[model samples]
Each structure stands twice: as C-alpha cells, then as structure tokens.
Target: MAHIHLGEGSFPLWALVLWTLLGVGLISAVVYRVRKGGIKTHQIALAGIGAAASFAIFQLNIPVWGGIHMNLTGLVGILAGPLLGALIALVVNIFSAALGHGAVGLLGANTLVNASEAIVAYYAFKTLMGMDWDVFPASASAATLGLSAGAFLMGAIIVISGVNGSALPRGDLTVAVAGLVGLNLGVAVIEGLLTGFIVQFLASVRPDLVGLTDRDTREETTGVTA
Candidate 1:
C-alpha cells in the first residue's frame, strides 16, 4: 500500500504457474522424505493447533472486493512448515475454489504466497520457542513476521499479474495493488497474532501437532546436551 508498484514484480500469470508447479514438486519430495523418516507420531493432530484452531481461524476474515476475503494462514504454516503447509494449502485452496473464493487457474499462486506465510511462521516460531519461556517469542513473532512477509508476497503477485495479463486494465492493476496491500496490513497483524497464539497453545496443549517443530526440538536438545 505504501507504494503502488511494490508488488508488481511477483505475480505474473506464467510466473505463478511456474511457482505452483515448483512448489508442488518440491513439497512432494519433502513429503516423501518425511514419510521415510517414520510413521506419524500420534497425539499430534494433523489439522493443527487442532480442528478447533482451524475453526477459530475460519471465524476471522477481512472482506475485500465484491467477492474476495482474507484471513490468517499463519497457523497452517506454523504447524506444517513449508512442505506440509503447502499441502494443507492445496487442500484448502481446492475447497475454496469449489466454494467460489478463487478459480482453479489462480490456485497455485495463492498457495505459493499464502503457504509461505505458514512455513515462515512454523520455522520462525519453532526456532524462537527453543529459547524457552513457554514459546513467548515464537507466539509473538511468527504472526507479525510471517504474515507481513506473506502480505508482501501476495501483494507482489497481484501487481505482476496485472502487468502480465491481457485481461486486466492498467489502472485497475495499480488500484488493486495498493488497495490489497493496505487492506492486507490489518489482516496480516491478525494473522500474526493468531499464529503466535496458536503456536503457544499447541505447544502447551498438544505440542505434537507440530511435526516439524517437535523434530527440531529433539535435534537441538540432543545436539546441545549430548
């Protein structure tokens, strides 16, 4: 929002397509690796933070356009890390498309931008949490940092798409770029807060929900204390 052109470099249609393909391919590889690592640890909820958490996120939304909306993807990323987060995104995006939030063509781009927020949230918070104090910094930091970056990523795509697409008007593109960014600021904050809260909650209530988080904790503790 601060600059109309700020996001103009990221979301061209072809670029989005490429990004989606790359993400799917990359995550697929990670998933394979994780599967080989061993079976899932029980007591860890896959939907994370838990279904209650997802339900909680569903309750929050920022209205945009005549038909669009935005909310936090922070929890998903935090729980899944990039790879699993992207997988969750793929499922959610599919459902959203069926419900008319977006078309199929743009699904990849959406996942690319938003899922990164989750991955960032997961790792950033997960790492900070290692310092102790009950995940205070992880909770406080992930949402703000991850969502801010996610907002920028999403904003970038909208601008680039306008430049690349034959169907979009130049003026409309600029307006959308600025408007979405401004609109996204509040949403990003909410996302960040939500991410932090959820991370802390799960870490306390059901830490196993975070597959990647637990693994890292084990590795760090083992490496340092050993």
Candidate 2:
C-alpha cells in the first residue's frame, strides 16, 4: 500500500526538487500556452473565474465533516493548472491569513497543499482527455479523482508535519483524517458536476480547445506534455 505520509527523513532534498520541478513546470506550460495564444477574451474570463473561486474558498472557513474545511480551490485546481491555481490559492491564503483565516506561517504549507491539488487535477484531467473514453464523463471522473487524491495527500502531509499532535487545536489525527477524506468525497461530486458542465460548454462553444492529434480519435490534451 502507498504510504499515508512521507516520513520526515523521506522528505529528501531530491524529492523536493522533483516536486518543485513538477509544480513549476506544470504552471509554466499553461502560462506559456495562454501567452502564446495571444490572450483570448475567454481565457481571461476563465482566469477571472478561477481567481474569484480561489479567493472565495480561501475566505470561507466553515468547518465541515468533523473539522475538515471545504474549499473550492480544489475546483480551481481542476479548472486551472498548478501554477495559476497555486498562485491564486497563495494570494487568497495570504490575504485570508492576514485577515485571520489561517496561521501566517502556514501559508507556505497551504499553498503547497492546494497547489498539489491543482497539479494532480491538471494532469489527471489531461490524461483522461487523452484516452479513448467519452470526453465529458471521462474528464469529469478524472477531475474528481485527481482532486480527491490531492485532498487525501494534503491531509497526510499535515499529519506528517506533526500538527496532529501539536498544541494547536486543529483536531486529532483521526478526526483530521476523517475530515479530509470526507471533504474530498464531497468535493469530488461537486467538481464532477462542475467539470461536466464546463467541459460540455467549452466543447459546444470552443471546440478548438480539444484539437485532434495525429489519430482521428486520439488527441493531445496539453501540447506541453510531449
């Protein structure tokens, strides 16, 4: 079975390097694509929607599913790539923390958690798009899976940080675990619905986004992946 969390010793410099590379590279490519395309109106609008969603999630602090917080920033990650999603979450977290939403020192960790969600969502969404399955259902399902996995991973990382046993009252590890899993499951359903709607809308209105690859059926989801 996969380890629930990477141990302290497990957080080697190499791992951080790889993760940073993956995280930064993912975002850079998406930015490059948008810039290369000459900044279409829809892309800008999408950026705005993504930005607003990130801010809303960051500000709202309703504790649910046994102390697990629900944030649509996971959905933001699904809609946008890691870089922009992480950047958006960072901005939101910074402002929210300033306004007293979360711990100030925790901003870096928060960005890491939320950004990981976006990275997973971006790749999983793209990979599903590359497959032979029906576009809408496949991508939607993959998006949910990606977000859920990220939530789970993020929860584990917090535990590894020993915040579970910290004097700070974030809640016990068991309670925190339950909340994380619960939030992920709930968020999955929401993102799945949203993804289905958005992808269908894009398909109908902007078919160019899903261009054909060499094969009649096969298509590249992200040009940067290759």
Candidate 3:
C-alpha cells in the first residue's frame, strides 16, 4: 500500500545508498535465519503460496486517492512469517517491477518498505496471539500497525530526499506527508479487514500452519527449550 512507484532519480545517490545498504542487511538477516531454521518443506511451500497470493492480490489495485492502492502485505506476513515474508515481498517487488508496476531503480527502497511491513505484521500478530486475544481483531490490529509503519517509512523517505527538490520545502513536504498519511490511514482499514478475515479462517481450519493450536504452541515452546 505504501509502495513508492517513482522512476529513476526519485532519490538522491546518498539516500539510495543508505536504503540499499539497509535492504541488503535485512535480506542477509532473513537468509541467515531461514538457513538456521533448516528451510522446512512447509516453509518453502508457504513462501511460494504467499508470494503468489501477494502478486495476484496487488493487481486488484482498488484505486484509492493519490494514486495509492490497497495491498495485502500483512496477509502475506501472517502466512509466511518474518523471514519468508520478507523474501516473498522481495520476490513480489521484483516481479512487479518487471511487470511495470514499479520502477527498477526504486526496488531497493520498495523492498525495504514492504519487508518492514511484513516483518512487523508477523511479529505483531504473534505477540497479540500470545496475549490470548481473538484472532480476527488481533490480526486486524497488527495489519493496521504494519501498514502504518510502511506509510511512515514512505513519508520519511520522501522528506529525507528533500521532497524531490533541493531542500524539503516545508509546506510542500507537509502537504505531501499529510496526504500520504491520510490515504494510508483509510487503506489500512481495508487491508486490516482483509487480513483479519483470511487469517481468522485459516486459524480456524489449519491452525497448525498459523501456530494457533495447542499442539503447535507446545512444539514451539519445546523448540525454544531445545
């Protein structure tokens, strides 16, 4: 939802370098964690499933104000967990760029934005679940938080890049950030509902996959102990 679809030259070289470094570091951490977890068959399958879902769903593109569209990144995170979620987001962004949904030059920044949303969504959901909350509401809140973070990151990037000018013109940057935040605040509700319902359904039926069942909880505890 907070994807930066700008073309080349959207960001200065320094900003690009910083974002690229952050993206690389995050991806590296994802790779390390995935490898440490031994890359289970279920994880691989879920990654493919989540990535496909994200790609297909992003095309829905409900035309919101300001050229922004609703996205299902939180749902992908709920399905794939953090590491696989970020990996799947990277795959989605790359494929989307190839398909002209975004620019190649913006891939690093977009990947970081999407991956942060996914990682936040995963952990937020897990934390809420640990607190004995109902799945739907918990998921909805987590999705909202995830999308909010992504939106804030997008605004920060724009501001730090001088709002595409020599300096961040205070008025223009304020208006731009206000618009971005307002649009995302509305879209976050849509995303949250979508994620909440889907996650609720999955938790009800395939609770093992979502770590919602007692058996899965016990195994998770045992793994931590081991």
For candidate 3, give the lDDT: 0.81
Residue pairs of candidate 3 with colliding backbone atoms: none
RMSD for all candidates, in order, please: 6.2, 8.3, 4.4
lDDT for residue 149 in candidate 1, whole number 0-100: 73
* RMSD of model 1 against the true structure: 6.2
lDDT of each: 0.58, 0.56, 0.81
- What digit string (tens of lDDT, one per residue) describes model 2 on residues 1-226? 0012222233334544544465466446656865676554544465568777666654544455423344555456545555566666666666766776655555445556666666676677667666755657755776677667666766665555544224545466657666667766776667666766766576667655433233333444434563
TM-score of each: 0.69, 0.64, 0.88
Off by over 4 Å in 1: 1-16, 48-61, 65-72, 131-134, 163-175, 207-226
lDDT score for residue 174 of model 1: 69
What is the per-residue lDDT of model 3 for residues 33-84, given as tens digits with 9 covering 90 to 100?
Answer: 8888766577678888888878887766655543677668887787778888
Task: Name the best candidate (by lDDT).
Answer: 3
Task: Give the alpha carbon lDDT tens digit for every residue of 63-149 in model 1.
Answer: 444222334456666555556565666666666556555556666676666667667777777677666534645665775676667
Candidate 2: which stretches are off by over 4 Å?
1-45, 65-70, 164-176, 209-226
Clashing pairs counted in every model: 6, 0, 0
